[model samples]
Target: MNEKLKKKSAKMTKKDGYKNIPSVDELMSMKQSGILIEKFGRKLVLYAARELQSIMRSNANTNTKDISSSINSLEEIVNKYVLKDKTIINGTGVIIHTNLGRVPLSSESIKSINSVNSSYTDLEFNINTGKRGERHKLLNAYLNILTGSEASYAVNNNASAIMLAIKDIVGKGEILISRGELVEIGGGFRIPEVIQASGAKLIEVGTTNKTYIRDYENAITKKTKAILKVHSSNFSLKGFTSMPTKKEISLLAKKHNIISIEDLGSGLLIDTKKMNLPNEPTIQDSIKSGIDIVTFSGDKLLGGPQAGIIIGREKLIHKISKNPMARAQRLDKSALSALTTTLKHYIEDEHLIKIPVWQMINMREKEIKKRVDAIIEEIPNNVRRVKGTSKIGGGTMPEAELPTWLLSIKIPNINTEELLKNLRDLPKPIIGRINDNNALIDIRTIPVEFDKYIIQSLNKLNKKYK
Candidate 1:
């Protein structure tokens, strides 16, 4: 260390700035700390106090040698810990945003989650028969009712579902997959890595841009146990790109007596073909086409909690269920409860407008404009409406765009970045896009329940930031 820095460090003592730091017992005695104690107990508060002391000592030169500043710093540290994992608004117009907790569950689903989590549930017991039963029975039943799959299973996420299936069906056997379909999903989850981790051999066929049915046929050997087709959900390859259809590959698998497994990553059950959106495979289509197994995500287009759903032939699903990894990667009671309610909505044909993801996708531009107009009417000074687009994020429908209307806010002297940052610091922070030197908030992604909140937030922003 530099001599001057060492001298500065040495100059700090208990009398200088260290004396200002509060004791854990002293801070806990305050009325504000009562709320924290009820929420996070005394141990955590003590831990926060120790962390504050460490930070205060490290910056002793800059820290004010006063009890009030130290108490303020302690309160700031406590508040930071309290709100570290709180939810925020997703005004960025990305539906199913992975970073912001993909696919906000419906009110019914949320209630189911709370119900199952708040009390004891029949999660693993069959009350009808008064016997031990499987946990995924209701979930599987809904998947079968909604997608016509003979059987189904629910795991923690799609990757674990794929891994469990491969480990059970094709362990130490060759899995024929297209070179183009070997994709890396969010958080560095690559198809090849998942396959290898499942103890299966990956045999890449065809080229990056194209893979014909003949490619799969040629790659098949005695060791090949499964033909894996992964939907490139997060990205699209345009221009001269080609891959074998699920039907064609399933037919080939049938002829060869090999398994055909398609990982329809973002599990869209709704027919969006009428919407002119880019084609995304559905579990129903793959299962109807004789695909042996289809796996997908519950959080993405399924509009459910984070889960990996496996639906396929009963024999294959039974085999997968027997694997030890099935228990290790199984969904908890709360997630299954939420997923069951979500699938019930889909099965009853009520999800077109009930599910948040579908509601956002099918939301009319006029509807968004109406909401935007309401916001602008409330805060008429600096906000105006403009045309914009929203994305079906969370690695699904990468090329699909929903026409949306956005609120273009112009606070007189506030720069775009600072304005956005300040909005993000609110009680329910607003996240928006910066376009043409203005902050744009898409109303399609914002729920109607938060309409007044958004309006009040913007008005408060106008006054506070200015």
Candidate 2:
């Protein structure tokens, strides 16, 4: 290979010298700071170091010292990439921000996680029978009570729930989905794509903007095994849109003896329709709507761990539970523990207000203004108050406008983008937006407790420029 054609190394070590690759202790103590993502930091450094040594092994004039230097440089590169990745941030006015990591678990959930993580206790053992037991048995009963389903189990996410369902029910047959309901999610998590992946044929029915009950009936044939209803969780179809309700689809599936499943992408437990959060059907409602199977995200609206809830007839759930794929996609004990804690909170009248995520979501404009005032009070006098926008994230209510307030600080000399990046680079990064040459900190998304920290961070940032 041409020397120049290869990626250039920033520097090379001397052929032989007093210095060699720094020990792990030396690397840890070095003033040089880069990134610090979980295990990736040390792991990548060693990985890169080994690869560099192999690459240099073939080249003439290669020496031990040069290899050491290559390792050091790779270590640095790994440091830069490994800093804690995009973590769960409760910003963006979205309680369940999918991109930022959905559903911050409750204190009780955290306790449960710690309890489970500390030791393994009957994850698959039946305590009463003194025999091997199903892992899903623990959570299935609670889920059944909430949804009134004959049986319930969980998978890793909403997509896997649908995938496992189709694999179990529609193998070697057609899975009918509404053309309009054929939807896409983050990372191209599409319904049609999932249907194709499930070893089943995609039978799309209905129109994008409008599809009648008759349209679905007309499309069904001997090959069809399942009817799919996917909620457009991320976006809304506005104006001149007509689609069959879940009730209608359920009835049709019943008459044809086809399994019906609604992938309630970001499913909720309680009805937030009263809050004017768009009417995404709840799991209970979907069950009542007469669907045989309902799949939903545990993390998105439930304010729990990231898992997929499958509620339906026990026979079907049993079939799905037995699938080899189910074993691969099952939630860990920690996730199950966290979910139980979160689900238990729903039994109270003020459950939504008590949980941090729901508490933030239900915060009123006046409440935000009060919190914004606290944030502004902590900041330097130059910061200005401005009205801003925050969305109900996790794709629940596309049209729901969260009334909010923002504190905008104009920093001279430094670029706004650079300033924002630096802020995010801080430990426990504070994420906000830049607008009108000001870094806007929308208080609606920020919790009241963060008021002091937000101000303290700004005070430090302002000093850097001064």
Best by lDDT: 1
Instruction: Give the clashing pairs for model 2.
Output: 35-83, 36-83, 36-84, 37-82, 37-83, 37-84
Model 1 Cα shift for residue 97 (angstroms): 0.9
Error of 2 at 161 (Å): 0.4
The digit string of per-residue lDDT tens for model 2 on 245-291 reads: 88999999999999998888776888887776766678898889999
**Candidate 1 Cα misplacement greater than 4 A, ranges:** 1-41, 56-68, 83-87
The clash count of every prediction, one per candidate, is: 0, 6
List of clashing residue pairs for candidate 1: none
lDDT of 1 by residue, 3-116 (tens): 998776678553376666666566667676666678877777777778877886666544443444555766677777674646688899999888788878988999998998
Give the Å shift of residue 409 in candidate 1.
0.9
Question: Runs in model 2 with CA error above 4 Å?
Answer: 1-75, 81-90, 126-134
lDDT agreement with native, every candidate: 0.87, 0.76
Q: What lDDT is reached at residue 154 by model 2?
A: 84
